[model samples]
Target: MRGHDRFNTSLPDDLIIEIFRRLDSKSKRDACSLVCHRWLRLHRLTRSSLKIGASGSPDRFLQILSTRFPNVTDIYVDERFAISPPPCIQGRKRSRDNSKVSSEESCGSVGNVDSPYLSDAGLAVIGNGFPKLEKLNLIWCSNVTSDGLASLARKCTYLKSLDLQGCYVRDQGLAAVGQCCKQLEDLNLRFCEGLTDTGLIELAVGVGKSLKSLGVAACAKITDSSMEAVGSHCGSLENLSLDSEFIHNQGILAVAGGCPHLKVIKLQCINVNDDALKAVGANCLSLMSLALYGFQRFTDKGFFAIGKGSKNLKNLTLSDCYFLSDKGLEAIATGCKELTHLEINGCHNIGTPGLQSVGKSCRHLTELALLYCQRIGDPGLLQIGQGCKYLRTLHLVDCSSIGDEGMCGIASGCKNLKKLHIRRCYEIGNKGIIAVGKHCKLLTDLNIRYCDRVGDEALIAIAEGCSLHYLNVSGCHQIGDAGVIAIARGCPQLCYLDVSVLQNLGDMVMTELAEHCPLLKEIVLSHCRQITDVGLTHLVKSCTMLESCHMVYCSGITSAGVATMVSSCPNIKKVLIEKWKVSQRTKRRAGSVISYFCVEL
Candidate 1:
């Protein structure tokens, strides 16, 4: 006990913080919240920024800040929803004399109330309160009129970054906020469907020269004239994301010709033919990141240009671009050596040779996603395994051609791999998964879903060798109780398991599986029709941590079983029940019980 205590205490605060920094925002919040009040105090003191805008509970956020917590410098007001009356309407309480229209009629559109958590009044309250805010990410706040933005701009004058991505703002809002925030360096207007070139022209002609980053992603309304004029004017623009159309070669050429300091560019679903990309490559010498996913006109020519130019590029994505072939990969291999992440999803023409070139040359690569690359067979997969030694993630989902050989190669060569996804690889059987278990001993996520040939043998291997935390063997028809038993015995750290569509998993298997993996938190056993009350009873009794359970099509389970699980496993956050129900009251009670229980816990 003393030794265990000492080991636990040995972990320092700095170490924990550094670890937490890598975690997602939600997980970090959860972890911080879990480590006792002392940790909470420490976290509040150490945390540099706090954003509580997803559901905009400004009161809750302020409550957290009131307790001598070091001021949250970076506050994000995620899209604010309007709970108040529409602009045209006066108050919430409607008159009995006048037949009040529905909320949509009052607001002109239902989307105005979709985020229904915040109001302009609420945001003004925040602006009035947190005056020292540094960064504000206001993404998809469609209902937040220009008045709210202007108020925020006036209040948070110390803000270095302001995000207005997807808001219903026009020229007046842009003109107001643009002149107000003198220190604003970053602005994201991606999919701000209401923004016109007139508004953009105002920003460009006036204060655009100060901007370091700007986003216009999926802004289909932007034309070549506006972009050309704007690109030439915004001399400080370093990063940009365009909607992949309208802004043609001339516009990009204007940008390259003007913004000498431009670095990162993302043109998703754009028609940037070879010449445009080449122009960017030739001009943007300081370019660091480029995502040209879904650019139908981009081909090997663009890759060649990138190889020749853009020497500082660190991230590249080429998803759904059909024209990229082996030659382009060869060019990329020869050119960019500092690449850390590469995504080539849906590039069917890029076969073994191109993959081999990439793997062999891009030694520093940490994450490689070849999702939906069907031409990647055993030989190609093997080459990747042998080449990319530093690879951390290998995603080959929906690549049906990979059989035993490819799986074996990945297992053997990519020892550093933490996440291996071979989902829907129908050709893979026990042989490949067994190989994976044997080689990638440190594997945390193993997704072998829809691999029908994989059965008890594969699970047995994984259970024995791999220290897996997340296991998804969904749709593996051959998997039986023996396999679940192996999972129980081998993976003590197992937290998430999906055995959906497993016909052989009966009540006994569920009992054993739940009992075996005490740390089981999330289980998806959908279509396991053989499971009855007995299995679920045992599951509820054993796996108290079970948060989300998908028991859809589980015909054997009755409302009594559900009630037992809900009552027993107080932490069961989500229970997806499609058919079975005792009563409407029972259903409502279950939902209410779960909500109350989760909050209390």
Candidate 2:
């Protein structure tokens, strides 16, 4: 030990720092901190990012964080810090009724020492502490008002990205951001209800030139005027996500006309129609990704315009656009030949014609999602399978019309398919899945939840042909021990597995897993009543690398089995079981090794 210490001491500080810089894992760095005071100090100095959650003493926590990671450029404070009040303020009486308190008073009361949550006082500490902070994510910090934001903006002048999602930042906060934080580029003000057109205009006028990405969701008061101001000012904006009730064509038109370099746009609006989309297609020639949700008024004409203009569009998502039929989708497919990803959900009118158009025109398409598009059947999938041979991912949910034929087509055509998720598609059966098992040699992730027709035959086929990393056949009642055993024997690289609600699964399956699966990290055996303590012990003893074990409602499992699992698996982080199954002794044992031992009621 002395010789080793002497040898380590001979290594220069710069070499040690370089070694620490190479460590990408937080756990490895934490272990280094325990080596000695010198190592701890070096680790702290090298740390450049910090994420903090609820602490008993927030002031002390902030002090330690600032002292340890003085060079941290990014800080993320989770919602727990805002929701969980410190003990000192928990028992204090409110000066006024909670409901009657003004937003400003509730959030910006810096003088109020009794503030339960992290108020402006906490923000002041942050502003003064981290001088190098370039990114700050105060997500869902509702108690943080305009005053806190102003303070942060003034102090963190080099801040490039700010996420004030669910904060009480009003016009004052926007004004401060505009006046200060000249280097700010990315801003997310989602769910900031206090923001109006006035505040948005001010922000656009101030930081529009440098801002690259902006998200303003659920800001009800923002209208066309604010968007017009943004369009006129924010010429450099590349990504924009807007979800507002009052925004219409005029606002969109202004944005399209101004931000010529815009690459991505996500809009969820009630008033936006074909005209706005036409304007976007015509003006934003650089657009690569577009997502429209719940836009009831958009029709084929708008899609035609988009296809005609935005030839470079690679990704498109249309959700709940009930008015858009096969014609609109066909138009898009014909124009956007470079599209790599397309997702259509709740567009009931879209059927085989639209999908066929996509398969024929968008040969480069790699990912496709059809959710609740009941009109689409095997013909549509067959078309896709025949045309889009490079397709890698396919998601089908509640597409009742799609059956074995479609699945077979997909399996045969997309030989390179890596991920396939099918849920509530009862029509698909063993024939379809077996084909996938045989054809998709590179299949890594498979989820067929609630696909009742899938049985042991499908699993056996998959186990024989494919080396899957993730497999979730939960609620597939037809799958039994044979299927699981085959999987355990075949998939040596399997990291995640969920066989929840399989009544037939028993100790035999566990025995197979123990002998075959050494890389299994997470397994969900929820409601598998036949799983007993004997099998679980064997499994836990063998699968030492298991990180998460969920055995909710496994009636055959007892305290002794739980104790063995918690004690044996040093890397185990989470365990889920029934409330009654966790004895006092087991709880104590689990409390040390497990980070989250949830007791399901």
Candidate 3:
């Protein structure tokens, strides 16, 4: 059907690259690289980022990376595990073994192994190799120390963003980074217990003037001293996230008062009161986003102060703030008219008036999430639907008082709504979900997990109305083949379906779903005992693109059925089965037969 000139040799270099770019998976890309020399070269050159995992020898991998992909700018080194010893230790194994411990003894050492994958030696190689590196994320690289970081900074002077979350980098490492990496703009040091105020102060003094974003979350030792240094030097800082108990009101005030151009701030589990809020409001008038969590000290007074002072505020999130009431919410509604996204979780004090005020005032609000707010009933949702007509994403979780009335209001008003998640709302039934489907035809993602009252009527409505790609109706015992048949007929483009724990689902629904939903990739049938081998055979034969099938506690599925499924769908990667169903040898064979098979039983 084709000639030699119409092949790869005739295609232009740019066209080859454009075609290669469209390949979806890594296997396809790797296969394309094997075609010719030009393709391999183009593939190598087009790549810009690299991720090195803690699997094989890091030294050898680094050597390969340096040789094959030399122009990589972004590198993410995940050192979450320990494999064999580093090349330095391996080379001198015999000599080291005579005086020091053996491999078994080394592996048995207490706590986490330092430099399990890439150690100081590996860092030296990296520093020498990637000269043009800009962004380096060594997240959970617990072994990297001061020497390695200093070497990286000295060699890679172009580095701008560095994340060392969960690393053991201490004050010395901070000092090294501060002294060498002066141009660094974004730095995250979350959960690094080795860091103290002295280290933080040195870092602030070194790059504070140039730094734009800084995250020092879970660094409990950091105090007002470090905050003072950051406030004084980091005047250009626009975003800061601090989750520390040691840094009290003094630290908050210092940072707020000093960073005049500050726009975004997130504080968690801190004992900050109205004084800190007032300082933030007064100084950071340009602030647009603020998030506070787990504090009762800053009540209505603090919120009112923020509302009155920071009139340009747009995004606000409050969680577990028991002290906040309708008064505080009203204050926010009156002041922050430019608000677009609002999320309130675990704050039960606010009533219907609070949501109504927010909905009426923040007319441009597009995203809203109200979770674990028992006081918010149908009245609150109705008000939100009536006022915030442009709302696109809505999440109402554990709001037991909300029922069909709230759903009707949202369906009637918010025509542009796309993503809706209502979980554990016992009051909501088929009426609410059906109303949602009847009104919101543009819906793509819908999650009604643990809403036992929703059944065939709701699914039928959803199938007819929305072109849903992801649908989750887990724990709805009333759902049966009729509802699933409706889904198969309506949502032909469905890719992900979760019908777990439904008692009435049988092989008929599975057969129809497999035959109709050609795009179906993942399906969860856990606890659905009615599904047998007939369903599995039909699913494997029809859904050729299926990747993962979770059938935990599915007693009807035996070893023969699983074997048949593997034979039918060679592309099926993950087949999760309950532990006690098959033998150990069978489990091992299943894994060998399929790419990814889990037998936890």
Candidate 4:
């Protein structure tokens, strides 16, 4: 007893609390709390954030949570809370009928008034419990209405950021928020269908001076009136995202002329012509990031204005802008010489000349993505590869014109590349892949999905040089045991691998994986009919750290093999296989240990 007491030196309370605060994992903190009563009290005092799921009784749970972690300033309510209604409201009938409830009162009439799932009463409990709450995220809480939001706003007066995505809150809630939360800076109301111009105007008038970031994407009822209100009131707004078909050039012009200090703007499916874009370029000189999607009306004139004016632009994304051609891209590339990231999707009119201009001008470019740009061919890619030597990530999807020459150029030039993804670029084959494997020594992630021309030669080269952590050659029918065996032998740190639909892969590859890749966690062998029970057993017995294993449609695996894997692999959590291969006994026993998914016959 004396020896044990001598070793038990008491640590200072402040030092113990600091140690608890440094722990990153919740489970680790919980374990530390179990050591003694003093440690548990210190852990609770240090914790400031709590994420609650929708499984327990809200009243009782919130009571206990407030008692234990009284200092928590942030709370995130899971989406599952809306899917599964609270148990207290399961059998109770709503006080108001749906037919009698008007559109304005729908939020308050969702369920029983006493129930916490849909009523303002539930929010009152949270507001009363956590008065110091600064950030609250209630994403997908569709049943909560304006009354609940008003109650929460009145109590949590210090709130700075509020995310109510997919909620049923309308104008009344915004009015309450503006009246109560004076320091609010960040607000997201994306997918809030009930919000209209009236509510937004109220919110803007109240909190416009303090607001920095505002997102009202997909609010169909809002029109030019709301944008005008925001521009007139919200002078300090910097980041804005607006998605509405009703908004046109007049609204965009107001925002551009009013918000001169804006840094980021994202517009989706808005009916704006070159005039609006020109206004943005001329007025918002501080803009650094811009994303435009499905704007068919914009032409080269708008892009030219942006390029000529917003010279400090660093990131730009253009998607489905069919009318914008090579001239527009060239203008942007020449003007925005400091661009670091560029993404072009479904812009078929922009071809080799535009890309060549980008390659020549944007030497600081680090990331580039070109998707469904059929007109962009090998010459364009070659120019990019030759110029953009500092590029780290490159993604080419459905760019059928890209061939071996373009890929080889990229491989040789972008020696610092870390991630490369090529999907459905059928023109690229073994030669291009071999060049990548030979030159890209720092490459950690490589995905060549559905590129049938890529085979063992490419994989063998990668295994020999690149220390890849993730490799996915799924749908590459030419890949076999020789390439995979080489990977197993060389890339010992490989964590994720997918060889689905590779018919030539057999037990030899599994044997090699078992012998070499002990850290392997997740593997997908779907549709590989050649893999047998022996190979499955060998993999599970050695790779004890495997958490997820998928072998769907593998006819050679039987119930015995499935049972062996479920019993032997201690860390296995998810196993996906054919329904017919699992026996009733195995299913019953595995139910407690792992989640098993069956592919229906």
Candidate 5:
């Protein structure tokens, strides 16, 4: 109906637009679009967002997206990927069974850290389809090569945020991305293995100046030269993660010199020496959060530099920096008055004196991790409890020297403790754990991994008092079947549990778990030989929602048993049975079990 002829539309233009925008799912929009010819012509030409999903209808979905949504601004995909196989010997031959395994699975053929194939190539295709695309996320798509990523950068002109996590793209891809996506703000290459010195140089030349946030974590190929390039080029960089063994004094110096406006920096597993640390302390004056885990060469000079420069530091970590002593910690305690989260895990030189300094000065400290700090005893723990009243999360894993007194003090003082990890602290007997569990009612996650003293009683107390959603009592050899069963009954909201080495678990615990937590999707019973066909039978029958079950080394499983469970659980995606085969009858029960396996252990 024409406007002059009194067009008989009931809704106003704005209302119509709002209604059109409310359609989120692509299938719904497509259904609406296909209803009539007039509806398609009347709707807005440009799509508000682009979601090219590979979940339901990959072919039709991409087709509609490419053809209809040409001006789409946002692009999101399920980047479930895998990597290629490494070079094998010339004469090596894989058997017919191995070929079956390879043919069934399209990605992650050799168990590369990230899913194998989906990232770069997938992004390239998506990019080619949507030239005006703004955001791209390629998580765990290791199969993506630099060529595919480069194609994306070259094609997608208006790209802003790009996440290439666990992808195989190197410097060439980064260089291309930097050059083409000039408007890029956030670039994440976390765990991208192929990036090296020359590639980093190319990257610096391309997008370093325009970048606000960049993550180069676990990029082992990067050295001091590339780091210097990053620091010099990306002076406005706010967040930087340099987790590499090669990044030493020179690389850190470059960062300090270039990115003075930085607020967050992570040097996890770095090899920075004293001079480099001093450079960081002196230059990055506006530092707020810093992580320096495993920088073994850290010394008093670095501390002094930090003490003088980052006087307003809020969060600091000196995890595994063994050379850092009480004097250095005292400097930090004295200097950074606003510090709230302090982690000195495995810093052996920081004894009671260091703890005293932290306790006396950092009143606002909420999260403290002193894991494996063997020198820190009850004296330090007492001091922490007495002074740091606001402490919420304490990680004392492997700090066996600090016994019941420390735990008792913590129980009394830190009433707000939510997450506690006393893993491997054999000295933290049942009484100490119980005392903490009794007091800390707000506990949502607890990890007593390798804590032999922790028994069924401790778990019972945890279940009774705390609302734990995540629990890991892995390697706690002392905890028997009764204790695990109590945990199943107690923690109703438990979503993630890792009781990998608990040998006592059997059919009863499985029954309780299945009955209590119907949402049980992932169960890792590795090394628990006691779990037999009966327990699996109960689990398969009850928890139909189970997605991934890891029953490796549970020799009790026979071919027939696995076959029965697999056939019954239609929703079961992946089941790990490293060394057993199912019977013909069980195989008969399976409709398409061949598609759900990655056989090589």
Candidate 6:
């Protein structure tokens, strides 16, 4: 028997189906399907999920999906309006086209009508097709109105998770979901401005016992009363997110008093003070993750109360909490020993002393983010590195005072670091990056954006030592073609690279990247003036797997260069080549036409 035949015979059909079911990534499953016909059939039969509505025509996608995967249980229809209609829409007219055209004209004559590609009729078709769908995501489906949502909700009664983010969902649509999807456990209504207290009350009463997670961020109309309804009815609620200027202490107290099982809460730009946080600390006994943002009225007193109450807290994010000082951080450090993930942003008053307290107290801290915290310097990082020896991820964006000494200190202690971002820390030079590259062997993602002093020495060191999958050296003018070549040669697994604004880099870097980094999926070369048609053509031809190429303000590139790249990589979605003012059209052939892509002047 041949190798394929032997392999197929080795594993039984049941075993093959079980093995294929365990594979998570779509790409991996696809590769496995290509092994043989038996595996292909098994893969298709076992697959139960599909995501469309981004590129292909929604109508055609629905027909194909219904025919191919009749047993699909989950569908995510994200019909983005950023680009024009896809290739499947052209030269194909629906039987109802004449009626749609006439109705559109009438609507246009009267007023504005946001006639989205995926209309109410399309949603009805989907509802009829996927009756067994348990999860449905209709994010950014702007044209989908209350009628369409109601139609979908009425049909998909088995839906446990429903995401209508950025949709035109209002009281009526929410009411429909509440009435139909009684088994719904997760609901996200982010950016649904048309929703209000009436809708919330209706939803709370309908899905009160089953609802576990709720997201209402950016829904400006939702008020304190709305939250009160949620707290009163959603007794089983475990996760809640609220944002905007309305939610206050009353709402916080209501939610806390009602939902004792709440484990996660994210409050952003709300008018809640120390009283609200204190309530959460006292009542939310199971709270483990808490995120606070734009709490101008909150002070150290609130954090102190929170720390004392929620001793089991594992994740905390504080952003724009300007009033919080060292005392608050000290309180938290002293109280919450279980804290493993912490992110502090725009807290100007927090310095090395506060960080030291956290480092010393929360020894298990594995993830930390300190953005725009200017008071932190070398000593602070040293303290953190020494105390949090198990640290795995660190992000220090625009912490201008940190230099080589701080980076070296971090490198010595955080040996297990996997991701490090030091954006706009201009004081640090090649030495700091070199230290990290040498010590942090597990680093897969590194961003040194706007660190102009970084040169080939640091890049070469990282390339030699680490196998990074994502690297962004944007605005590091000191790096050139030689540095990129070293990176391509050493780190052959690079998937995303952003070397924008490197004036010295030419097509040579592209050639090297194309030849070595076969896994490169996205490349950003904005303002790379030296890169020309010669280099770009080689890149497109060699790196056929590339999905997106951004080359803004590259004066050397021309219309011909873009044409060559697109013609070769026809599946490429985003090819942003602005500032060069290049636009070219290829002659259309039978049964095929060039897809409309984004091209701005």
What local lDDT score does residue 251 receive in model 5, on the 0 to 100 scale? 81
Better of 2 and 5 by TM-score: 2
Poorly placed runs, candidate 3 (over 4 Å): 1-32, 81-116, 582-601
- Cα lDDT of model 2 by residue, 396-426, tens digit: 9999999999999999999999999999999
- In candidate 4, what are the lDDT values of residues 449-479, reduced to their tens digit? 9998999999999998798889899999899
For candidate 2, report its TM-score.
Answer: 0.91
**Collision count for each candidate, in order:** 1, 0, 3, 0, 10, 0
Instruction: Tell me the TM-score of each prediction against the true structure.
Output: 0.81, 0.91, 0.89, 0.91, 0.74, 0.83
Off by over 4 Å in 5: 1-65, 68-127, 137-154, 163-180, 188-209, 216-233, 243-251, 268-272, 497-506, 526-544, 553-564, 567-571, 584-601
RMSD of 5: 8.0
At residue 310, give the lDDT of candidate 6: 92
| Each candidate: RMSD | 8.0, 5.2, 4.9, 5.5, 8.0, 5.5
Model 1: which residue pairs collide?
244-270
Q: Clash pairs of candidate 3?
A: 578-601, 579-601, 580-601
Q: Rate the local accuracy (lDDT) of all candidates.
A: 0.74, 0.86, 0.82, 0.85, 0.74, 0.83
Cα lDDT of model 6 by residue, 422-451, tens digit: 789899899988998899899899988999
Per-residue lDDT tens digits of candidate 1, residues 108-178?
Answer: 32222333444455456556656777787766766567776777667777777877777777767776666
Looking at model 3, report the run of 10 residues with the lowest lDDT sum.
106-115
- Backbone collision tally, model 4: 0
The sequence of per-residue lDDT tens digits that candidate 3 reaches over residues 430-484 is 9988988999988999889999898999999999899999989899878888988
Output the better candidate (4/5) by lDDT: 4
- Model 1, position 19, has a per-residue lDDT of 61
